[model samples]
Target: DMTMVLRVIIRNRLSENLRHRFLLNEPVDVILMFGQIMQRNSFTLMCSSLRAHHCPDDVNNPVKEVCPQDTDSRDGFIFARDIPDRSTQSYRVQFRSLILEKKLGDALAIHDKIVSKDKRLIDRSAYNILIWGCGKYGYSRKAYELYTKMKESQLAPSNVTYTSLFNSFANSPYKSESLKLCEKVLRDVKKFDINLNYINYHAMIKAYGRCGDILMAFDLVDEMMSKKIPVNSETISFLLQGCLSQTESGFILAIMIWGKMKQYRIPRIIQHYNLLLRITKSCGVKEAASLHVFLMKNPTFFLPISLLDTESNASENTSKLLPITKKSRDDSAFSNYDSPEKRYNGLGGLDGLLAMMKKDKIKPDIKFFTNILELVPDCDTSENEILNAMSINKVQPDDVFLCMLMKKRCSYNNYEGAKEVLKLFNEYNVKLNVLVYGILATTCRTANDAKMYLESLDSNEIRLNVQILGCMLNNACRSLDYQYIIYLMKQYKIHKITPSKQCLKSLANAHKRGRQIELDIDNNVDVPKKLRQRIKRISYKHFVMSYRPWIKLVRNSEADPWEQFTVKYEDD
Candidate 1:
């Protein structure tokens, strides 16, 4: 309401002939102060600071304050001028600042205000600035809209604008729409006969890579090489990110892509190496573990000796000092994790990452530990390393880990492991929240075991939630327990709790097997009619929860955590 009122006042008082004109017969100082306040407060320009630009070479530093240059005063516009008229260029700098700071809403509002006040204020430079901001900020649709708007305003989008448009897809979460927008941008570029540059080609390659068209991305890379533009670190990083977006399914492809970097002779950085670890995470635990060993053995891959490896006898007498892992007991043969291309010689997933961190003497931080607790839950070695690293850092176990560890462990029916993790949490004084206590109940493999756990816990300390309720139903999953699954579906009316997709999926699995189970009633029974009804009703309810009158999901905009938690509460 205040913003609307302010806009109305500005429109009424600020004349279209804004050449030193003032309304209300106010003093010059008051008029200037009001103008400053409107621009600063209303448009939010006061809170921005100029930083890096998307295309570093294209940006020019702002000059000192100067008098306003008329948008069209017969002088031809210089797109690459270093000393721009301050009144116009200052705003451009401010807009770029907001963009770099990721204040897209503020930047958009300011751009619209400038356009409304004087369309002439929006020259090709300003349009490019706005387009670039929208593209960088995951607003691909908005970026596309602004691109069309530029054409309608008789302002042709230059190569920079096209590059920004391509970037709109590169970072976009909406891959399909971004690809469509990219196609439109390509058509416009061809239609305009605008010559392409290295930067433009790179941006298009990244866009295609991120949008899951790695073949297209590869073609562009080939084109860049054909045109004598060397494949650089940035290009390799973009391809790595593309592989990451596809998850473990792209592991072989990633190896082939890594060969390209090797082919071009680009040295691997911490970022690229880190990306490799994340991509390898999906390639079975055994393969990933071997990769870790390979990376640690290689001196060329940044050899700061591990804190453990410091002992002279650590390598030679390692078997005597260390306990055997499951991998060693089962299959002792050495193997390589590679695709058709043997270029990516040794790339491990989470296990390799831990080894790399140990070698670098980089004590893994709490954020890294917490993120991987989800990513590589079954890695016992990683868990032990995380604890040791925390001990070295002297950081306490986070309260979240208490609850979260239970959820992940219980999902796998690792009851003993869940109990051990909770004990570790207790040693560090982690609070026993409802999430922890409830999920702990489900950790027990059998309903009788779960009932015993529930019986043993103190009533005052254990409060039940959807997660707890899910646990109570012991919604026995991933194994042959079905009592909790059927029981949970029936109890929704008596208990107010959100339905989880994990539980829903478990129910689907049970339906597939048509397995009958022993209910607490001491007789075997099949879950048929009630299960079907609840599935239909809850499925519709969950849909309503994910979709609504408001634009995006509440998981993002409205801080609706309950819905978010239940949506992705469990991995399986």
Candidate 2:
């Protein structure tokens, strides 16, 4: 017992000494203090520094602030300690700090310095960190170069290293090159016997999606399933978005993927259902109804079988414990699953679906009702069901819910009903966000009362976004009211909001019409110098990317011959 106690005391002392050494000033100080006698301790201290020095590049850029003076004279600093490991550790910390700050140039310089000074000190992780930082900052080409260098160094890369490389190539500006890199990585993962994780599969799928290669994305999904790696919900979401953007077969593909998700027992929430609805919109009413019926009747296979069994046992126990009386019979029932025949009987329509939800005690929320409202078009019964669900569940109607209501009313040419939804904002004391105002702006344009809503917005002090501004300009162009367009220009100027090409094109169209009416906004055949300068600063890439979807939806909503007019404006 005494000998064992002595051994424990000695082990504790050694651990304490190692801990004390790691708690020094920095990696450099620890190495200098112990030298070669504590090589493992020194190496560990250096790694810990990497963890300690990590900060988000966007949050703070260490390159903006001057590095410490000791980092400059590496030879002199190392000569003071006469140890090569210390020198390498010093470089690692500096490189890590620069990369974390998003100072790519500075980090590259340090990399060159480390190679020239001593290649022995730099390891795989040092290269991986720099690659990750470069990828994150959109310098994917640089990350690839570093990846190649890492291979040449003969250091075997880990899963994290490959994940970073895959991510870098995915985010690369050149889509063709990114696709090539993705394929190469997929091959390498198998060749090297690296255990492929969900992250690796997700990055590959997303890369394919971004390149508009929806088929490749699905093929990768099949490969992922074959490997027995569970598909992530986020991965499915990306695939759905890619399908929506790229394929004629997207509707069928999305439904198939949804079914597959159920088969694989992948967890999904309302957000996933919303994506399904958005994708189904392109498929038409009949397809949407079929999807609704399928969802209502099908049991979610994602739920665990064991959990159902446990629930059944609990219910049986509770029923047995219940008092057996003639007047008050035991009513404890726990079986949640209905007969397959009964489930099929509930597939009549939207009302049937809602009744099934209520029968199953699935409390419907705002998103649930929004998706239902979208499916059942021009139905007062669907609207009443939404109101009843909200009232019973006490789910406060959000801006999205209100917008859907307004849109449905407008679709039925019930402009008065749409306007009443706007009034309900004040009645419900709901704060009007940008999206709500955008919905109202569209309603105003449809009602031919854009000017009234514009004035109402000013009185209400509702902040104006570009959507509201564009709506006013569009309405002005239709009315040949160039004065109203000028009023919108001044309103945006007051709000300090920049106009996009779409806004400018609308103004130009209005100018062509207003010449006969003696409207005075246009000064010449060419745009004014101030307006031209503002247009120069506008990014057409951002404008088109953000507003094209909105424009598509608006055009789809109502077919006006003027909708055929394509807005033309250049960006710098």
Candidate 3:
């Protein structure tokens, strides 16, 4: 019935050609309306069938043929023009895309258009997007530009906005520009009722420190403290770094910051302790010991008394143990507890740390161990004290700390101590990584011990890296060990380690000394294309000046030129 009625309507209404092309079924819109009116229990089925029958074919449909250019103005407006809601969403999408793409100019233009059209729609979310984008792309000017625009549009900046701006300027190449921005932001903090949070102050301090303006960083901290802004871990860390080069002033400032933190009961983070450790290490273990004793006596000034107190009763009885007046606790901690001689005798530097460890019963971590090791060079502590610390705690030194010790020993050419460290690693069952091998190799090279060099290579514990290879090549050339040169080339091939400029230079010199002229040519031939030209230039110079004259003398004698050249080179 459905097909019969539609077919009859189509045949009666138009010419045969038109009937074939024009759809004479109920109009699609009409079918939809009819389905709704009939409550076609199967609405989905009816709609699918209707769509299928009335679907436009490109060859026959007039609507499909009608392009945008052919549409009348009203029809165009109804079908193709953007609605306000759609336009808003599209603008947001495009703005985000531009911001992500780091197309700052495009983003700014779009942002401006959106604001101009509807100022009320701009929110913190939108502002954050722009601020973060600007910082990440290193576009400080655009970031400032956006800030000024946001303010002009009456969108109040939040603390986050200020933080982002501060961070952007802090990381920018123009250090003065960052400082100027920080000053301006700080000045405006109260006017805008913005809380200059720890992050903002930290960024400013770090920026100052990084630019080598330690005094400025100190002044900024003083300004913050004077303003009653709290000192935090970041603030203390920044001050500590600046103090490294200027020991006295830096230590004073660090102690002052620590005092402030303690007064406020801010828990000292690990970094804070590390900084204190470094200061003590620099001053010498004896001084560090005295400082430690002073800190322990004045626990309330450096650490929370609660951390030092083992039992709950100690905390409850804190007032009973000490005079317990707030002002006395603050002022009396750093005051002279005893005469200098008495204090130094009572608490030797490393002994002070040992006493603290015993009192607290807290095992020192790796950083703590390293700090002690660093202080060793400055301490009068005997080797027994050093060995005892390692033996008791079973603390294994990492490659970096071990390497530092190796370098110290090598400076004095103390090969015995260097050998002892390798023995210690073996005794402890510590697996030697590539770095450890490199350090050993370097030490051996510095001592010019070829036997040790070969021994290091024979060790299964260490793998060879580029640095090790370089050290080997350097030693081989300096000692004129031609056989070692052949061994290095074979090892390089087996390990697939590429030689660096220094390594190649040393190898070439070694080859010339060994009179392995053919091997030297082969090595040069295999050099990377870019480096080959440079090596050739250097090799040519050395050959003409050093080898050519020797060659001429040998040839002038009754000796065969090539054989004499080989003999003279080998003898050297």
Q: How well does candidate 2 match the true structure in TM-score terms?
A: 0.52
Candidate 3 structure quality by residue, lDDT tens digits, 326-375: 33333234233223232222234456655545544556555766665655
TM-scores of the candidates are 0.51, 0.52, 0.43
Q: Where does candidate 1 clash, by residue pair? A: none
TM accuracy, model 1: 0.51
Please rank every candidate by lDDT, starting with the best. 2, 1, 3
Q: Name the candidate, 1 or 2, with the larger TM-score value.
A: 2
- Which is the winner by lDDT between candidate 1 and candidate 2? 2
Ranking by TM-score: 2, 1, 3
Q: What residue pairs clash in candidate 2, if any at all?
A: none
Task: Tell me the alpha-carbon RMSD of every candidate.
Answer: 14.6, 16.0, 19.8
* Candidate topping TM-score: 2
Best by lDDT: 2
Off by over 4 Å in 3: 1-157, 164-181, 184-193, 209-235, 245-248, 256-269, 280-348, 354-363, 378-384, 390-396, 424-431, 444-572
